[model samples]
Target: MRKSPAAKAWTRCAVSGIAAAVALSASLSGCGLPAADPGNPGRPVAAAAAAGSQGAAGNPAAVTAGSRVLNPANGRLEAVVPEVSRTVLLIGDSQSEPVDGWPRLGLAAAGYNVYFCGRGGTGFVSSNGATGNYIDALLRGDWLLPSGTPALIVIQGGGNDAAGAASDRQITANAERLIAELRERYPSTPMAMIGTLARGEAHGGGRRTEVDALLGSVAASHALPFVSVGDWLTRYGLAKDLADTVHMNPAGRQKLGVLLEGRLRDLGLDRKPTADQQPLRASGTRDDGPGQD
Candidate 1:
């Protein structure tokens, strides 16, 4: 009643194949880029282009997505979610990691689902149509919510656009376009755009200040509530809080989330900062108001 040698060899081979397949599946699922649904067939967005944009010259190496820092080479940390949940789509550099993005923890603490769309090295200006400027991609991809509307959309970006190579006016203009596009797409969704965090020697001290001012102007022009994390960094004193001259560490991200919760509440996105946030500010700007040209 003994099995043949050939039979035993086949069994081992089958088990090895199954194990390999399982491991591959697990890896993909964890990354949150599962293959497109079979029943409802359509092409998924161009992930290659998205990946390239994150790696473009002078961009950050990582991005915060959901509750993880996404490595472009490997989508690492893209799918993992913290226990408490409510989605906040982030758009920014490594400075916006889920733990660093703060809104993920803040909104989740207040009971909401959060998703991180943190794209490293992304800017408001089009990368020559490469990644479709964050706002344009959001609208085209319907990034608001699964129901086509989200409770809140938090944007943190533009640090790269603050380059000396580009005039302050140019940076400001690009940011304005970003805000305008978002307004046109998701008119009623409450949005909060964060200013850059810390300044570095790259722009000299003054250029950083100019960047913050231009960002503030964009928020005001759109009438969307703004959170000046850059200003907050100055007020809080940078040396101790920052992990580096530029980005913050995990502890820093937690502080940011706590501060941002209040801003969302003030803008009427959340009721009391301790409870579920409600959408307060109308989604679209004056120009893109409901049914208005």
Candidate 2:
């Protein structure tokens, strides 16, 4: 409809106000979160690139530790069997709560073929409250073990599950079903259930014990290794070490990476690089393509 100049001006003003409000809402939603730092890499083992950098020149321990952490031999888990052949599948929420620089750092340092299959707000329970189809979609999708049978499957989720309207039994059952499917699909693969970390004061005391018990029982029933972050948080004082209620800071991520590195090693799932090998990250796809579940 035709409008006078004054009316047109008012319409423009209203549109601009709406845009401003939308932008402000987005900004507010991102509060209390660490902006993704590709530089941080979140690897428990230091990166080789960083090793030659000025930082590592001064601190040689960083490089040595990186090699040690990545060296499958140094991983002393008796159950691991220390094999050079293995790949990793990382499934979790934002608070799968990795240790330092993550995905880039931790996966790289560990030298495993890591497929990070985590989506924000998706959890073992709720299935996004029956409306969200992340899990079912993932199962039908093709996000896991691209290199073939992964020696280990690391399910690092449950934070969102706890918050979801679904019952604890439902969450635990879903997780168990997932593990059972993995076992059926890849019988040789060992499943590792990494429990969610404790949120600091913001969550009114984290690590829902009810959920923990459920996860533990399911993991035990399946004979899968269960690593609880609850002990780490209690031992380390989560409030002091955590960056926030859920996510960990750089130091926290690193510490968590160290713990996972050990766990992965014990599973005999850590891989080593060969002289002729090229780094996977140099050619890795940020998107593993499409979901399969």
Candidate 3:
């Protein structure tokens, strides 16, 4: 029988970029968020302020969960101050999907309202037969946050591109384009990039290593923080956490989440909640670990 498209995509990522794929999967899955509540979708950090509550002079009467407040003095949204509950925009591939990834969980744990946009089999330089590459998706406005401007924007990928053998020039050009577009849109917001993942003894080390180096160079040129988790599985003793060669098991996912949370904190991207703010939690369960597949 022929493999399904989803299956084929998974196979391609695994076969071409198994080390990268596994590392990405571990980083994301390990940091999975608590299941979302049906009543309160998306904006998990804090409850919405009461409607008609006064904000700065010219701002809207109702303060939505993640909406920008109008600055009465300046009469412009641009002057709006960062709220106690910050917002984060995360863009990546299957590994960092919003469903239950570490980026989502780590940010949420840090009292952030996370907007995640990720597609399986997609990357900075290659789409792995998906609809569009990262640049195309960003240009088309595929993964924008709904309301307020994100305080932090994170871009994660390159595994698929490395696996697909995307040229360094292609990767660098697309990354630059993506950064330029983001800067134009959110000039003041801080940005960061998480590079491709890898295992220490992987056979495809050459390409994955090259992709990691290219990503580092791009981040440096753009003056953005770059976190490389390529050898996380081996370095962190997470080899036994693999559900497969390219995906993490439940235990591995938990470990990855802890590791990522620390990284985010170390970079100063993840902040603790203020006294009045509360961390987001699911209605039923407190434990946010990924369920059995």
Query: Against the true structure, whose TM-score is highest?
Result: 3
Question: So what's the TM-score on candidate 2?
Answer: 0.55
Off by over 4 Å in 3: 1-85, 128-130, 201-204, 279-293
Worst 10 residues of 2 by lDDT: 24-33
Top lDDT hit: 3
Model 3 gets an lDDT of: 0.57
TM-score of 1: 0.56
Residues 1-293, model 2: lDDT tens digits? 88986466445434433332332211101101122222355742234333333344577444321122122222211111112244455665555312222332344345554444544556675343222323553454422223235545677656666655557678867876788766765567666777656543344544454455567777888887776654456555545666555566655554555555556567654565578754331002222111111
Q: Output the lDDT of residue 16, model 3.
A: 23
Count of clashing residue pairs in every prediction:
15, 26, 9
- Report the C-alpha lDDT of model 3 over 196-267, residue by residue, as the tens digit: 656643644466657877898999998899887777777777767776555576456555655665687798
